[model samples]
Target chain A: GESVGLHLPTLSVQEGDNSIINCAYSNSASDYFIWYKQESGKGPQFIIDIRSNMDKRQGQRVTVLLNKTVKHLSLQIAATQPGDSAVYFCAEVISGSARQLTFGSGTQLTVLP
Target chain B: SQTIHQWPATLVQPVGSPLSLECTVEGTSNPNLYWYRQAAGRGLQLLFYSVGIGQISSEVPQNLSASRPQDRQFILSSKKLLLSDSGFYLCAWWSDEVYTFGSGTRLTVV
Candidate 1:
């Protein structure tokens, strides 16, 4: 049962606006892709990766968009602050499996003020 | 500068008791170790993984168990402690470009 899901459990931006978090994957040989940033208690911070041959990848202000036809994966946060809120994860790696990482179903970004 | 450490950040075992969770990695060396679990809000749940020292790979088979003697060390065991084993416990390492997590261990199986 290969699964990695997230269609937005929660997300709200305002600070500087511009934010988008959405992920949907079921593993189609998943070729490495990651985006993580979890604050609340820390642990899980590495915010940009894409390697299904590469579709898009940018860091600093964050940006990762990979749509292997439709597996879909996106995370873009340009200005939104408030420490950028919290929880945001999307991971998938199964191209010979370097160490296995299949995460998703997490999106709770609340930045407003 | 690489670092990853997981310990008793919080734990309160009970229900049959018996469990150990510890992961260590510093500056990397033969790196590639992971153990993740998260419940409260869901996501991140890839049980065990190791690439050296004794070698282990179990993506969830229940009861839980994992160990990687040394070489950055990694261990997660359980002989009992059910109650769904509470939640939150992460330890990761794998850097070609990313993945470095620790500072998480909050079990509570009362």
Candidate 2:
């Protein structure tokens, strides 16, 4: 039963502060990972993605870090804002199976004023 | 700009009722289509995927089935709905190593 999981179910961060969310995946064959943000009653929006060959990838105000040694992944949002409050998910694509992505349970991020 | 459309944004159906959810992709052709379900406080679960027309792969054994009648059209159906089937259903298409999801359908089986 290979799966991806998050370390925290919920997170609270002060506005303008940096926020970090962590995830752990059990599949060693995973070659690609993605981070998504989903607001209430909306579809998950792609934030950023990283390949197994690279350890980190950065996007606008966001960064994704991958640790193959420990099968850990993290998403960092700089200058967290009220609009950044949403449920974040981490998904993994296994090698040779690019059509499907195994998703993590997701972490609810709440930005506080 | 490729976009995915899923219809019946919100649906309320009684148990044992028939169900049909349609999804279509625009601005793209022969793209990989997928159906995923997200329960309250849960992650996305892959229900079905189609790489091409008339080709479907089921990820989970459930009371649901999918069909790809056209290159850009994917449909999810069930002869009789169940209470456990209630959730947020999402349709997605793969492009450039990323998945673009539709707004999603909130199905509430009473």
Candidate 3:
């Protein structure tokens, strides 16, 4: 009963440009959301997270925006670098007696110099 | 200050063979452990999770099974490998807001 998807499968951006990766979740009851970045041949790493009550949260050079009304979550990276080239995934934490996290199809971000 | 270790970075096993992947965590106690499988170009699918030692919750029913023998150890196994079981397996630990992951194991059941 949980589905999360991305608008695009891959995004190509030039170096130093700002990159925005979008995600749409179907579950509105999710209490928290997190964005993860996965590099080739490695496990995913946490980039940022946002609670359902808040609309936006900022970390070093990245930001997470949550729109509960539309069940949309987005990750914005400033000054995209070559090192930032990776697959990004958004996960929504369904809260209750059991903690279930639903992950969306990742968007592969390719930074071109 | 928590870290996870997953071994056998890559394995090529034949069908009908037994499978075992190990994951261990350090610097934390009683952390939540998870086993995830990722097929090519697909999102992570949660296979099993353990809240504590001997407390395992399975999300999906398949050829695989998980075990938590110790507080910081989680293992995923199967009696006989299947071709469908070949994929990238990831081990993770969650505490507080952040979830840290191990280097992952790539299993190829041929």
Candidate 4:
């Protein structure tokens, strides 16, 4: 079975620095991508999403870049704050199906002061 | 605004005990419902999905089963839970745009 994976299990960053988390998805058929942030003991909150037709999309202090050629997706956060410390996950959806989503292993982002 | 609700934030069940987790969505109708399980420090795994009432699709064959009795209610159940069933169970709803996940339920089987 194909799966999505994170390049690193954990990422540490200093406050005020930019943070980037990477993901690789095995399903080439995936046409839609989304980034989610989950704080401890909470449900995942949608951060941003990008469709296959576009290469990049930006939201408040966050940007999502998708390189379909390499089946890679990355989330970039600016001015990392201690409050930004959480687990980030990327999910993929195929073209024909919007009912199911494939999720990547999460990366724990820890911000250091 | 749509919202998802999952009950029993945490549960400790003895092995072989029956299991039931309920999920409901509000402010949305005819939306697709899904159940996913995440093991400790692992990615989310799709377990089941429902497009409509009485229609259930099992993604990965296992001891788990799902049912949709109403338009916005989905249930995951097992006749006898296995020790391996211990994990975090998440309920999600999908609209035309994106999916919304519920506060997951953590189940610990002894």
Candidate 5:
């Protein structure tokens, strides 16, 4: 089965520091990817997305970088805050597959004050 | 603006009880709808999806099923639930290459 997985299950960072989360996907046919943030007891919220055609995309204080060669994806958050503490997931979608997304196991991010 | 709505924010049922979870999309028509299940601290698993009314595609075979009765309404149902059925259920609508998920329903089958 094709799977998207995160390298780390947990991360801890200072409030003012940056945070980096990594994901590896097994589906080479995946053309679109998205990063989502999920708070406790809430649905996952879309944070950012990037198509395979682009290597990097930036949004607000977050950036998504994709490496097709290694089938790797990463999300970077700057100036992490308490509100930024949550589980993050990376999802991949194969183009023309009815836009069905395969999600990775989330990484718990704890921002220390 | 489009939004997805799922009902019964939380539910508790005994094993063998029936189940029905409803989801609807507002401000959008003829959109793709999906149902996903997530266990505690785990990734989402695609259960079913519908492209249009009366059209459904099941990604995995399970004890559950889904239906699209209207253009914007999707429903998930099970005749008899098992303890394994307990989890967080999410409904989503796809548009403009993005998926918007509902708040989700927390189901506990004891």
Candidate 6:
């Protein structure tokens, strides 16, 4: 099954610095994309989402960029805080349905002070 | 003010035992409900989804089944437990262009 995957399994960044997590999906039919943050012992929390029609969308201190040309997605967190350290996932859904979401393996972000 | 509620924070069941996990959504109606399972350090795996009462869609074939008797209620059940079934279970609801997830249920089949 073609699914979503992260380029890096783990990432380390200094506090206050920007962090970028990358994802590559193989499903061209995927038109809706979302970013989720999951802390240990908790369910996933939605951060931001972008539709295929748009290339970029920004929310709060987070930004999601989608590139349909390469089937790529990225999440950027500005001024990363200590609490920002967690596993980030990129999920995609095919057209006409937000019911079924395919999630990536996820990237673990570690913020260092 | 939509919220999702899942019962029994944790459970330990022996093999061959029956299992049932329930989830309910408040402050919403006719919402899309989904069931997901996550293993240690793994991504969310979609198990089942329901668009309305008595309408259940299975994503992956396993030892589990889902049912929705009402608009805001979803349930996961299994007749026999498999050790491989031990994992974290989460219920989610999509409504008003927003997605909300319950705290989650930790199941251990020993």
Q: Write the per-residue lDDT of candidate 6 for residues B51-92, one digit (tens) a residue.
A: 899999999999999999999999999999999999999999
Model 6 chain A poorest ten-residue lDDT run = A93-102
Better of 1 and 5 by lDDT: 5
Model 5 pairs in collision: none
TM-score of each: 0.34, 0.97, 0.96, 0.96, 0.98, 0.96
Which scores greater on lDDT, model 2 or model 6?
2
**Per-residue accuracy of model 3 over A48-69 as CA lDDT, tens digit each:** 9899999999999999999888
- lDDT measured at residue A10 in model 2 versus the true structure, 0 to 100: 99
> How well does candidate 5 score on lDDT at residue B2?
84
Q: Estimate, for each residue in A8-38, the C-alpha lDDT of model 6 and write its tens digit.
A: 9999999999999999999988878999999
lDDT of 1 by residue, A54-104 (tens): 888888888898988998989999988899899998989877645588888
Supply the global lDDT for candidate 3: 0.91
Expressed as tens digits, the lDDT of each residue in B19-107 for candidate 3 is 99999999988888899999988889999988889999999999899999999999999999999999999998887666778899999
Task: Put down candidate 4 lDDT per residue, A1-113, tens digits, no spaces.
Answer: 77788999999999999999999998877778999998877778899999989999999999999998998999999999999999999999866654478899899999999
Clashing pairs in 6: none
**By lDDT, is 3 or 4 better?**
4
Q: Between the candidate structures 3 and 4, which one is better when assessed by DockQ?
A: 4
lDDT of each: 0.86, 0.94, 0.91, 0.91, 0.94, 0.92
Which pairs of residues collide in model 3? none
Interface root mean square deviation per prediction = 8.1, 1.4, 1.5, 1.5, 1.0, 1.4
- Chain A TM-scores in order: 0.33, 0.97, 0.97, 0.96, 0.98, 0.96
Q: Distance (Å) between predicted and true CA of A45, model 1?
A: 16
Query: Candidate 3, TM-score vs. the true structure?
Result: 0.96
Off by over 4 Å in 1: A1-16, A19-30, A34-51, A57-74, A78-85, A97-99, A102-110, B1-14, B17-36, B39-45, B48-79, B82-84, B88-107
